[model samples]
Target: MDIKNIRQEMALLDDVIPLEGHHYAACLQTYEAASSQRKLILEWFTNHVIPQIPRDSASFLSIGCGAGELDVKILAAAKEQASTIAYVGLEPDSKQCERFTASMALPSDQNIRVETLNTNFEKYTEQRRFDRVLMVHSLYYMNDPERAIEKALNLVNESGKLIILIASNDTLNELSSSFWQMENGGSTWFSEDLSKHLDKRGVAFDRHRIKAKLDITSCCAPESEQGIRIADFIAQAPTGELPPGLRTMIFSYLEATSHLDGEMRWLPHNVDAFII
Candidate 1:
């Protein structure tokens, strides 16, 4: 990673403008289509974790379950063992919450009782503990990840488990960290940091490495709308709106990090699953 180069470029910028509204949504869609985030998580949760799922309560507590797309799949994974799934999602984004509520209304999710709270994990006031808890790809948004993890764990019943999906010094996150700092004024945490925190707290956990990738050929196309959108998603910022030097630097870093295999540009999208 060209951390120094990105830092140099970011220093030339006033601030990072985070992509929001429809543009962000579009970029996310492109990223999702190219990445295997949902499939990897769903398969791992079903094959490796679901068999050991405690049957105390068919209830599931998902922290930062965005838009309910993955939540529906997760609940489905537990369906073979439990007739119905009680799903409660915690997300601070109201727009996403609305989408979640709408998506959960589909007949396919009829067996799951879905409840969404447009609030952060730290602000959830539910006193009821859940039999299973999940915090997939959502921990990076936490102001205090340790507190949030402890809170999520506290919400899990004795026989239940807490599954936290995060990245292990995820390469793409390194490319985005500089922009994130500019946007949030602080550094973000990764799986290694979380593991160290758990170890320091004497919380034993099993870490599983899940491999995935993305076809980032579109991201390499500097002028195309789809390319810009994917690049924006990668940097978590408006790549086109960025300072010229920083924008070029970031794309250079991305291109350098990505490897070419025939006609496809494969960008590593690996993640780590921490099961406690």
Candidate 2:
């Protein structure tokens, strides 16, 4: 279950499912019960990160900017703080790029402008740097995560920063690991590993933990539509039908690690924040 093996399996999954669609959206909705990850990140950005940057005009580049929610949030915060901002988003899906473009439509009076490119980061050779380069929840999907990290770091200006947000291995790792193990898949990448990648490359960074939770109560039911959907969502590698034994094992592992409160089964979210 090394990095190389996990990456090969992830590439295979990506070939099957392009990482965007109805099931993916549904999975995101289900995970909304544990929203503290984004909240804490946003809080830190506004209160701590933004203030530390002395520049009044900031540039941001987002790789795999899904739905452009983070871009919108960043722009809104910048406007409130009287900071002029320029944002560029890179996404492979045309539909998602369209959404990212639409989400960036700021009012005439606002001090923010957005541009989007419909392409994956690996193929994008545009040479430009920005004040803030974002890789939120997108690094793991890269074809070469190390290369991508290096490219992103190279794109950061002297006064700029590379902000990365990823799920810690401690949270939801068992379910994904078990799913891959059943299929002879390898280990997946997490924030902890990403930090190691940075360290290996001699990149300096600051790490922070964001406390949150994940609700997997419905995933306990293997046969139901919700259960299957949850499995597909978290595994991100749903092929045809999952064997019953694998599903049972996944649910049992989830149940074992989960804490039940009323109708909600809460699993602690280990969200790690990296700033370079």
Clashing pairs in 1: none
lDDT of 2 by residue, 1-276 (tens): 233343344344323332247566666555553445667677867875666654578888989897787678877776665467778998887877888888888668556778899998989888788888988888767756778888998898988899888888774665564444444434557887898888887878899888877667777754656655655666664523444444354456567767898988778876787889
Clash counts for all predictions: 0, 0
**What tens-digit string does per-residue lDDT give for candidate 1 at 1-276?**
487878876777776678777777778878888787668878988888777765544888888887888887776667777866788888888888898888767476566688889997778878888878988888888888888888888898877789899977767788666677778888878889999999999999999999888778877885877777778887888877877877787777777888899988878888899989
Name the lDDT of candidate 1. 0.81
What's the TM-score of each model vs. the native? 0.93, 0.83
In order, the Cα lDDT scores of the candidates are 0.81, 0.71
Off by over 4 Å in 1: 106-111
Alpha-carbon error at 9 in model 2, in Å? 15
Worst 10 residues of 1 by lDDT: 103-112
